[model samples]
Target: MSNVSYYTAEGLKKLRDELSQLKDVERPKASQAIADARDKGDLSENAEYDAAKEAQGLLEMRIAKLEETLAGARLIDESQLDTSKVLVHSTVKIKNQVNGMEMTYKLVAQSEADLKTGKISVDSPIGKGLLGKSVGDVAEIQVPNGIMKFDVLEISRD
Candidate 1:
């Protein structure tokens, strides 16, 4: 059974575009490289040919993995998302209990997580600890440094 990956509409579209590019552009380029290398010299001891073949293999493997991920992906409807508790796509405001510093983050899919933009992956340690938590709830998350506590102040969909 394939585990379904929840993605936003934009994320799914991005995946599709990437797959198309890989199949149309990269795949053909790899094949052409192999063909050119093979034409250059003898097959038995041609390092260039071997390297081209290896690169093609790696490219095909990447294409296959992307296809598999797309097969199990499902687009999440933003309008249907619940805002009462922390969940994927929810922008949550939290306060560090130890330092009283407040920060906001949007829990998103792994593909869309960008820390510089305050988007965090749902599978991340802090995100996992915040999932399903409500306002006034304190979430304890184990990090590389040590355990940290966060107080959930608000949950909103943006």
Candidate 2:
């Protein structure tokens, strides 16, 4: 059974758009590439044909995975989200306990997480530690390196 993933409207739309692009745009391109390579003669020794076939296989696998992910995705209503504590889709501002450095991150689904944009997956160490925390609450997160402490400064819904 596929595990369900919760997404905001925008995130769900993005996933749908990506899945459509892969099927509509990329699938055809992969097929054409295979056809072009096949026309180059002897399939026994043709590296291009082999490469094209491999690429198509990889593309098909990605399409299948994306479809499965979409099938189990549920959209979360942002307006109904509680702002009193950290949860999925919550925008949280936190401060480092030792260094006093402040950072903010929006907790998102694993598929939508992008560290460069300050979006973290709920499965992440910090995100897990911050979950259910209220403002001013201290969270001790265990990372690969060591344990890190953070103070929840604020929580808001986007």
Candidate 3:
């Protein structure tokens, strides 16, 4: 069975938009490129044709992957989210126990995780450690660098 991905309404819409673009625009462009290449020359000796075919294959693969992702996606209503504990779509404030540095991040799906936006995937080390934790709880997260401790300060839905 495929894993179910939880996403905010906006995130689900973004995925749908991307899928639509890939299907309506990119797929046709790839088909046109392949057709143009085919008109150029012999199949075995044509490098342009080979390149175009390869590009088409890559595009189809991406489309298939995106379709599968969209199929397994479940949208979460932001207004109905519980803020009492850390969960997907929850903005969590935490303090590094070792350095006393405070940081905030929103738990999001892998497709929507953007470091610049302070969103982390629930599959990430820190996000996994923070899941199900409430305020005042200390999470021990194992990152590539090392294990770090963070004290949960607040949890809210944004």
Candidate 4:
């Protein structure tokens, strides 16, 4: 089964750029290294040749994985998203019920998740709990530490 996932325009572009770099630059370099090693000595005993072959195999595997990811990626239309509830690509401000601390987070695809930037994957515990929650709704998330409640303060599209 194909694993379909949505991505923002910027995120899609980044994936495409990385794929291009791997195919156009890294692939050629890997091939050249193997060729150079093969020409140096016998393939049976040459460690350099074996290392180059292994590196090329790894490079090819990475390229194949990237291609698969791109194949299943769909671009998300930000304008079409609803601002009334938390969803993928939603920017939500939530206040911790216990500490009264407020934090804003953007729900994004797994590939685009970056905690430092406040972008969390939709598959995450907090994101799953917050999904479909409207403003003023309370989300009880089951985290690794324990259960934590967050009050939805606002939902916006960014």
Candidate 5:
């Protein structure tokens, strides 16, 4: 059973571009590495050949996994999303009820999550807790430490 992943148009484009790079550039590089290793020495005792083979196997596995993820990727229309509740692609302003710290984050897909840019995965603890929450709603999130509370200040579609 393959899980479906939702992405914005830009996010989907990024994924497609990455897949293209892996297929066009990295694939050939792996093949070349194997060829170079094969020409180096005897088949039985060559460490370089074994290393190259292992590297190629890992590369192929990554490609296969990316392909699978791409197959189930679905593009989400930003304009169609409801801004009343927190959801994927929704820019939410939340206040930590514990320490009075306010933070804003845009909920994105797993692949597009970048904490540095304030884009968080919807599968994350805070994101999951914020899902379907509206303005003025208090959400109790379970973190590794303990349960933390957050107050939803606003929700908007970016």
Candidate 6:
């Protein structure tokens, strides 16, 4: 099965930049480390050589994984997103039913989720609960503690 992922333009660029940095910069550094270690002494007794080889293997694995992610990534057009309801890339303003606290969040792809920036993954508990909900609808999200209700005050693009 193919694992497809969606990303915003900035998120996609960040991924591509990371892949390029790993392949172009880190790959050669790993190769050089291996070569340096190999030149030090006999292969059987060289701990540096073993360590270098292991590091190279890890780097290669990371590169391969990023390549796969990039292959399956699709860019999302924010302009085409529906603002009438909560969906991926929707900037939603919600009010806590119990505390009366209001907060805003932008639902994004899992890889791009950053709470510090008010971006939450669509796969998250709150995001999943809020999906398909329109303004004035209440979302009951089940957390480890209990169910928390959030009233959808507004939904917009951007």
Best of the candidates, lDDT: 2
Please write out the lDDT profile of model 3 over residues 46-135, one tens digit for every residue.
898898889989988988988899989998888886788899999999999999999999999999999999999999999999999999
* For every candidate, C-alpha RMSD to the true structure in Å: 1.3, 0.8, 1.0, 1.2, 0.9, 1.3
What residue runs in model 3 are displaced by over 4 Å at the alpha carbon? Answer: none
How many backbone collisions does model 1 have? 0
* CA-lDDT, candidates in order: 0.91, 0.94, 0.92, 0.94, 0.92, 0.92
> Clash totals for all models, in order?
0, 0, 0, 0, 0, 0
Q: Higher-lDDT candidate among 1 and 2?
A: 2
What is the alpha-carbon lDDT for the whole of candidate 6?
Answer: 0.92
lDDT of model 5 at position 5: 84
Question: Per-residue lDDT for 7-48 in model 2, tens only?
Answer: 998999999999999999999999999999999999999999
Model 2's number of clashes is 0
**Each model's TM-score, in the order given?**
0.93, 0.97, 0.96, 0.94, 0.97, 0.93
Query: 48-100, model 5: which lDDT tens digit per residue?
Result: 89998998899889888888888889999888888888888999999998899
Between the candidate structures 1 and 4, which one is better when assessed by lDDT?
4
Poorest 10 consecutive residues of model 3 by lDDT? 75-84
lDDT of 6 by residue, 1-158 (tens): 45787888999999999999999999999999999999997999999999999999999999998888888889988898877999888999999999999999999878789999999999999999999999999999999999999999999987
Better of 1 and 3 by lDDT: 3
Q: Tens digits of per-residue lDDT for model 4 on 42-126?
A: 8999999999999999999999988988999999898988889898999999999999999999999888999999999999999
Give lDDT for model 4: 0.94
Question: How large an RMSD does model 6 have?
Answer: 1.3
